[model samples]
Target: MTGASPLRPDEAALREAIVHTAREMERLGINQGTSGNVSARCADGLLITPSGVPATALHEDAIVWLPLDVAADAPVLSERKPSSEWRMHRDILRARPELNAVVHTHSVAATAMAIHSRDIPAHHYMVAVAGGNSIRCAPYATFGSQALSDYAVAALQERYACLLAHHGVIAASATLSRALWIANEVEVLAKQYLLASQLGTPPLLSDDEMAEVLEKFRNYGMRGTSGNGAH
Candidate 1:
């Protein structure tokens, strides 16, 4: 079963969400031009951002739809080329079945942190958005290649998000909206960490403390807590 049986009716909603999120990223200065791509798994196929298209100019029909199954060297749904990083997107979906949405961004801070010698420590609880610890950066790989896809899959093991060294950040979630939110949160946290480090050795949370917060987060609903306890 292709993840909820391809909601054709939901395609409009999905397209709108992708367009809005891409525009939002540009507005927030997280993505520039058409440097990043986003995708959401649908029952019919995967809905992905078309390559070389500016976020501001993306229309609903401009979004490319690729079938979950590869058929005769083409996607069953359309003839258009998928994202340049389609393999990475496909691998992420294959590895994390629960993840319905994936957001990849070329944000400055996160990309900078990805190339750093040290891992990003859990300095704040917001890191829980990335599986409740710290985001791991996958080793550097040539973009748009199987090596990069494999590296991303490895880094995403047991985590909801990962950074691509010298490239960008990738975040996945059960929903497209949540994935976008988490991606934004990651960039924010990365920027904060970068700034703090410039101030001469930022304080990091201890392992025990991070574990405690992660446990608490699990009880509070691992996704996130709403204003009410309904989460």
Candidate 2:
């Protein structure tokens, strides 16, 4: 608890969700220590987990409040320093209005694939969950730079998830849970792809096949939405 005083009830709840999402990432083994970050849109900005702080030790007020237009040197404005990847989170949240939550993780399998600069092909139907036939791997960049954020935005084209080369995985969605779910699913796909590679290249589904699956997802996949299923 620090500067800028208190949070409204809903904002407080969102902070709690951010913390819970971060903790869940570790428990699911998709993240470790302070290796990942989580955030959700609020008011005119986003509430992101602070830098180098373990999720289990996070408290609501310790979350960093980054205005969408926060200046580069204004990290001091927030009570705590935002995550080192704050640039990526800020860029994604600002660029994708439909996505309210963003989660970045160094999940083992996903990062392993990223290190190889391998994109996950549509070898599985669930690959369409990311809104494409494949999950892309962004080119490598310094961890906390605008260059990394630029690469991430490009790689996430038409998709909710992407792999950061030599770094980790990142996913953004309309909700905290959905973003985390997408990250987890990305890791699963990465693991499957790696295992299958050992037995020779996996047969990829055709474009038409993925198209049909995407259409079905648009119709009945979501409880009450369009093309918004978990897949």
Candidate 3:
């Protein structure tokens, strides 16, 4: 038989962070009622937002905890169902062991950019927040499906964030709060790019310049700071 999984004291902390950040996202207009979900890795499993539940109403106990090793047929942790996109969270955690948190949201600017025919360029230094050189958008796929998960994983290659075509954005990080911070920064950048593009052609940083910025990100004080800059 498989060994019993260990418990995680950090699970409660993660749950609270998810709820709090989800509300923040809503307040900032990054997410709407019941439209976004956040997940974080726990020692034994995962903590995730419940489906069809608004961020404004989330409670700690209301969050769902799914055992990582549980049989697919086994009962889930809460009476409230887990997010339909749990599969995406599962795949990301399985593929990127270093990532502790995953956030998916339908923020306006990011989603608008995702619908464009091209990738979101790293024209600015802040692009490093999402990892690698640029933010990529995965091809459109039905939400909550394996196809979507596969596309997201593929787009996330060597990157911490990706835009879901016709859908939203996904960002992962080493901590729950950091993940949320990156997601927020991505939206802000998207908004800037949109406005800049309308004002005329936006100057884009060259590949070498972006590389330098990414290198700097490794030592940047903001790299892992969280909770509205509380650090």
Give the best candidate by TM-score. Answer: 2
Give per-residue CA lDDT, model 2, range 1-231, as digits (tens).
332423556987898898889999999999998899998888878888889899788887788887777767774545568899888988999898888999999999999989999899999988887888899999999999999999999999788899999999999888888888888989999999989989999999999999888777666553122343454
Provide the overall lDDT of each model, using Cα atoms, as 2-decimal numbers.
0.78, 0.85, 0.80
TM-score for every candidate vs. truth? 0.88, 0.92, 0.89
Candidate 2 pairs with clashing backbones:
none
Judged by lDDT against the true structure, how good is candidate 3? 0.80
Tens digits of per-residue lDDT for model 3, 1-231: 112224576666777888887888898788999998998888757778888899988888767777665443565633447888888888888888888889999999999988873567876777877776689999999988889999999998888899999999999988877887788888988998998899897898888998887776665654554533412
TM-score of candidate 2 relative to the true fold: 0.92
Better of 2 and 3 by lDDT: 2
Tally clashes: model 2.
0
Per-residue accuracy of model 1 over 1-231 as CA lDDT, tens digit each: 221234577788888888887888788788899898998887746788888898989877777777656443553324575678887887888777878888899988888888772456698777766875678889888888889989999988988888998899998888776777778888988988988888888788877887877787678776542321213
* Model 3 poorest 10 in a row by lDDT: 222-231
lDDT of 3 at 211: 82
Superposition TM-score, candidate 1 onto the true structure? 0.88
Candidate 2 yields a Cα-based lDDT of 0.85
